[model samples]
Target: MAQEMTPTQLQAWRALYRADTLLFTHIENTLRARLKMSYFEHEVLRILDAAGGRLRMAPLAEQLMISRSGATRLVGKLEEKDGYVARRNTPEDRRATWAELTDDGRKALKEAQPVVEAVVATFFADHVSNEDLRAASRILDVLADANPNDDGFDCGL
Candidate 1:
């Protein structure tokens, strides 16, 4: 049988897992009830926004830890809502498609930014000190490096 985790390991794992779960639920619910956007949606917008308002479908999927088809489906839904997004073929690579954030999408993202910031500050950041955040980030990086195949990094979002 495999050995059990040490107390330090367990604490770190539980703290990160619990915090992520609770934060995701709280942020997603707040967006859904107040802004009619899912937390995933906000994340996509933020990513695209950070990437100069455009990112290819595959990279976006990889960043979000979802499948290609799932990304397409989610983008399709958002596309219908007043042209929030536009999909285009990458001329150099027909197989690669791009999702460009439209003006409406940017507007929506701008509006949602404060809501997200506030919720995050209230639920996550407020409880942690600056030094702890730095240490947590480093610990997470170490953890992520140990599990490279997982492709989920705290630094990504």
Candidate 2:
């Protein structure tokens, strides 16, 4: 059985929902205008860049909180349309595959980062006090581990 949420928890959930919706909409629009890609795609590129510009397919899917098929489809778009990403088979295990960020993907991520950083600074950072940030960080960190599958941190609406 599911535990009931306290009234305060319910209120917090509502507030978080509203704020997240607004924030993502703003960022997604900004990204669409400048980068011509969804925020998720941008995130994939960013993650690949951070992971030495490559990651195995299974881990990438998990990190993205997407099914393997979904990850493959998304990567396929990145591969076919813009050549921003590519896949390779491992010689040792032909069944194992990896996706790598191309130079174009790196350049695209670099271009998008400034826009994202500026918007986050203006809308999120400027309003929140340092104390509030610390408190929220603690709360989020607690919530981060609540997922049984360990995929909760990445899959936000």
Candidate 3:
């Protein structure tokens, strides 16, 4: 059997989990209340925008840390309900599909960016010292690298 965590290790884990939950909840609530956008929707747009406004469905799902079908459904909702995203099939590979952000999506993201930034500043960055912030970032990076998803796509860990 594997060794169990030490008391310090357990405390660190709990602290990380609690901090993540609180921050995520606050950000999600702020985004929904201020901009009428779900956190996932904003994340989808953010990822696509970072990828030059278009990405393959599988990679998008990978980046979103969701299942393929979940990505499809989310993209469907963004497309059908809000006209924020569009799907296109590549002629070179009929089986592969791409999700592209619409101009409206860009506009929506632009509007929501400030809300997210303010929340991050107020709830997270503002409270942590710069030294602790850097240390936390490095520690989180190591944790993410150590525990990677098993999905075929590169987790970028």
Candidate 4:
């Protein structure tokens, strides 16, 4: 049996959608102005930083929830901006190229960390009570656990 959501539930869902959009937009703008990094660029840099400063192209694409072509384009842009570099991993697989974080990329991420943390704390964390945050985390964990391909999702959020 399925029950229809009430108007209040519908409204809440809509609010959640709007909140997600606004929060992401705010963060994007902040990062761009403060660090000269777009949201996607920041995400790529973050992933590289987490992967010990390097990641295979295929895995990076999967982690970023983007196509291989899309990842290549993003990597090209990052390389042009001197944030990172792509190199052929001939020993592992001659056909595949890996993206490695440059020293400048690490410096950039470190510089942006404070601003990013402040924005996150101010906009997202400050509004929620401690108990509510804990509950939301638990719910999110449950949802993530139910997904079989959790690693295929973007790491930005």
Candidate 5:
């Protein structure tokens, strides 16, 4: 059975939720306004770039913390509309597909990198001390370890 959260715990949860939502919204809005890129799209490109400009579709979805189909749609848009990504099928496995970052994607990421860095620093890093950030990082590690799966959380919302 699930244990009921104490008042303090509930308050902490609420605070965390509000902070996450607000921060996310702020970053999302800023990225959209300045670069015309959604956070997820930017993340996809970033992840692909980090993976040496190419990754299998499943792992890409996993790293993005989204469903495979969601990754597919995003990749499709990046491929067709933006020409930022390309898909290639593996010879060993006909079903396996790789998402590769295009030259345009690299240029876009180069452009958006500063925007993301500045926004994160101004909106988040400025407010939190190094000590606070370290403590938060430890706490977040615990919370993340409690649920180690890579699957998305569905609250039926």
Candidate 6:
């Protein structure tokens, strides 16, 4: 038989879940209103921006903890809406394509930065001490490392 959590443990789990949900909700709303971008969309752009402004589809999918198809779909949506990303066949591997962030994508990211930064600071930083933040980061990093997939959830579709 599996051991049951105590009431305190259950409460702690619930609190953490609620906190995470609220944090994401807050960020999502802010991003949608200010930048017309979903959280996932923002994340995609941010990752591309950080990766010297381009990345192969497979590597980008891995880095984003998403499947290739999922990344392709997301990239397609971004391409349709903003024309900020393009897919090109890799010269080294004709079978593979690269997702490159366009100049417009860089500009969109730059425009969104201020709003995202303020939201992050207000919702996360203002509430947590530096030590608490560092400890939380360490804990999450450990949890991620222990998981079979670097992503916490199975990308079942």
132, model 2: CA deviation in Å?
1.5
Off by over 4 Å in 1: 149-157
lDDT of 5 by residue, 101-133 (tens): 999999999999998898888878899999999
The per-residue C-alpha lDDT of model 6 at residue 125 equals: 86
Measured by C-alpha RMSD in angstroms, how accurate is candidate 4?
A: 3.4
- Each candidate's clash count: 0, 0, 0, 0, 0, 0
Off by over 4 Å in 3: 152-157
What are the root-mean-square deviations of the candidates from the true structure over C-alphas? Answer: 3.3, 2.3, 3.0, 3.4, 2.0, 2.2
> What is the RMSD, in Å, between candidate 6 and the native fold over all Cα?
2.2
Residue-level lDDT of model 2, residues 1-157, one tens digit each, is 9999999999999998888788888889999998898888888898899899999878888878877777888888888997889999988999988999999999989999998988788778789999998998898878856764464343532
Of the candidates numbered 4 and 5, which has the greater lDDT value? 5
Candidate 5 overall lDDT versus native: 0.89
TM-score of each: 0.87, 0.90, 0.93, 0.82, 0.93, 0.88
What local lDDT score does residue 82 receive in model 2, on the 0 to 100 scale? 77
Q: Candidate 6: lDDT over CA atoms?
A: 0.84
**Every candidate's lDDT:** 0.85, 0.85, 0.90, 0.81, 0.89, 0.84
TM-score of 5: 0.93
lDDT per residue (tens digit) for residues 1-77 in model 3:
98999999999989998988898899999998988898889999999999999999988998887788888999999
lDDT score, residue 145, model 6? 82
Please say which candidate is ahead in lDDT: 2 or 3: 3
- lDDT for predicted candidate 1 compared with the true structure: 0.85
- Which is superior by TM-score, 4 or 5? 5
